[model samples]
Target: MTQPTIVFSPLQAGVPAAGGALEVLVRVQAPDRPTDLATAHLPKRLALVVDRSGSMNGQPLQEALRCVTHIASHLTSQDALALVVYDDKVDTLLPLQPMRSTDAVAKAVAGVEAGGMTNLHGGWLAGAQQLEGGTEQTVSRVILLSDGQANHGETDLSAIEAQCREWLGRGVSTTTVGLGRGFNEDLMIGMARAGGGQNYYGETAADLYDSFDEELALLQAMYLRQVGLKLLPAAGVIVEMISPAQQLADGSWRMTDLAWGAEAWVAVRLHLSPGMAGQTRDLLAASVSGTALDGTQLQAHAPVLQLPVLDAAAMQALPRNETAYTRLEELAFAKASEHLRQLAKEGDRQATQQALDVLEKRFGHHPWLSAKIKQLRQLADEDSEMMAKEVRYSMMRMSRRLVSKEEMAYEGDETHVSESVMPSFMRKKVSEGKGKKREV
Candidate 1:
């Protein structure tokens, strides 16, 4: 049988869009074969951490157990699998052991029991330890699941973040999954970001199985490791990574959550020199270690996308224009402006307040921005630590939107406030009972 070959093709490039941005499209392909591509043995080590807190006693625990069993069954005897369970304390049910022994794997996963409080830190530590030692060529990873907050052992979130950073530095990737509504979404997402992996939300036990299956499928299909793009733009050209992820120590950039499935696409923006005519320039180069399921490594290189630098006059002369590029440009500007606003608020409160005021006066018609300003004002007034943290968490999670009315209620609480709850005192008059008070 012939081995399958993966290929990528450039679809489009250098098209002027709204806000003076350009769009590039590419397609990835893998030739069809008979046997499962994922059945091949790869030098990969996976640590599975399950939440066995009291809240997970029933359906959650059962689903997690089933998921781990399925994961183990899929792995070749050559791969390694470690199982860790955490509640008030962390315990490794199965150390870094080969997945080839079905009976041993089954026994390890079947022993998981639920009780006590959620100790996320301990679980992470245990998982990190399991992945500590590996050959330079091995791919180490951790899959963590939890259904509640970390209230038992080492509740310091910053410390946990620092640990994750350290682990990623050592070439171990950690992905986190929130099992239910009780789990801290912000913490899980932040940990995933810090650990250089992905975060997932599972609303129910069934969802847990689905998430596990999806993750396993992706892992099996990975033909490359340490994949990254190095853009060396010509003079007067600027290249920016649209996706917010850094290259790993192995020189491969971990794909962000945005580019997970086969259907998802990755995008980048390029700024050209002014008054420059149509001239082809090397946009970027992508490098990935092509590896088969059996751990055989090969080198794969993507040809640089040649971009034409068009002058302003020439841009205007281009034929029937599509607004896709313009929309992307607008999205980029909105994202950047929101980020700046957040940084200003964190770094200098006074400057942030002034900037908010100016933005409100100028773009007050934008409902989302307007609503965010109102929320900020309300947070500033109430001076409630919990509310402030909640607002900040919401902003970080919903950065794509200036305002998200769906309030993220405090953990173990169900109360929620509307976006209109906090009116901007500067722009609108307060209402007394049934009537709106006139602004003086």
Candidate 2:
């Protein structure tokens, strides 16, 4: 089996003689060989948890059931599957069992009807329980679909995060899909992060299929799990991670799964103290540990990058990595967007506007981002819920939006995935650019 590669890009030019800012871009490349889904044959234990709240009575419920049908039809006999539906009460539509016959599962999904308020916690927990009986070698996951807030049975965000963390500790990952504008984006995003899984947004009924298909593609292509990075920063240097994670007590961060032919990048800003002139010092070091696709342990260390404290002129003579700078800009925008969204969620209109003003002053030159900022400011004034949801979705999918055309393309004969799977905001942003320079 091929091993993943680790590369680090530090500040190209040396630091100022009296010490200056430092930023490092850490990129983890997937295995050298492309993933072969037919050959990999990774077994999956999947739980499909669908919300049947009153709001999903019409097209929403129909679309959800149709999507689930598509997902069921693609499963193999070796995979274990469970279906759960909830609306103020939980119902196990189909008990956990291997997919030897999908007809019964599809029939069960078709019989679900929408009613009552959402009991998100109960539904999600029931789904997680179904996977507990699966083998340790299976890739166990819960695909949670919801179109409303948690109105019954443990609605608190903290409580929900704790519960999800408990499930993740038991080796089950939960991937959350917010069905429409009515869903609470913050709650879904938080739950997914705590579960060490992926989060998605479906703006319209038609969008549900895209979210379902993309997630399936990822699962079928995933090659690594238990991904963790140990950062060994040089003494006296402070490290601040800009990625979503569960920070360990020892200062390391826990990451999610890594798929084949995909790249995971982590960005960290280093705060350094001034050193004596004409001397070199180690900036940072990192080691990656994870479980590979073939059920083998994998470990790789990134090269240590050293910084030189030199004259300002000498530092200016060095070449910089333009790609690294672009990636950093993307990370900064994502961070600011998240902060602004949180402010909007709290109904602090003034603070939200102030944050937007600051971002405009910093990134107004970029057309797409500037347009997005303006759109968000208007939404904040008119509808805070919409603004918050938009911000979270945009930031969550930023990396996918910035990927090159080749990276987004698929080589397999999966002809059903012809529709655009990107979020609506991303589509609009890409269309307005007219081939302008991308900030990410």
TM-score for all models, in order of appearance: 0.59, 0.82
For candidate 2, the per-residue lDDT at 282 reads 81
* Model 2 lDDT per residue over 49-161, tens place: 99998988988887677757767877898888899999999999988888888788878976899999999999999999998855556788998988898999999999999
Off by over 4 Å in 1: 1-20, 25-39, 100-112, 136-139, 154-159, 169-171, 247-265, 278-305, 308-440
For residues 206-319, write the lDDT of model 1, one tens digit per residue: 544434544554554444433333344445547565544465566454443211122122345566444335556565555444343334554445566665556556556655
Clashing pairs in 1: 17-326, 18-325, 18-326, 40-293, 41-293, 77-100, 226-252, 227-252, 227-253
**Cα-based lDDT for every prediction:** 0.55, 0.73
lDDT score, candidate 2, position 315: 75
Candidate 2 off by > 4 Å: 34-39, 100-102, 338-361, 364-384, 399-440
Error of 2 at 289 (Å): 1.2
lDDT of 1: 0.55
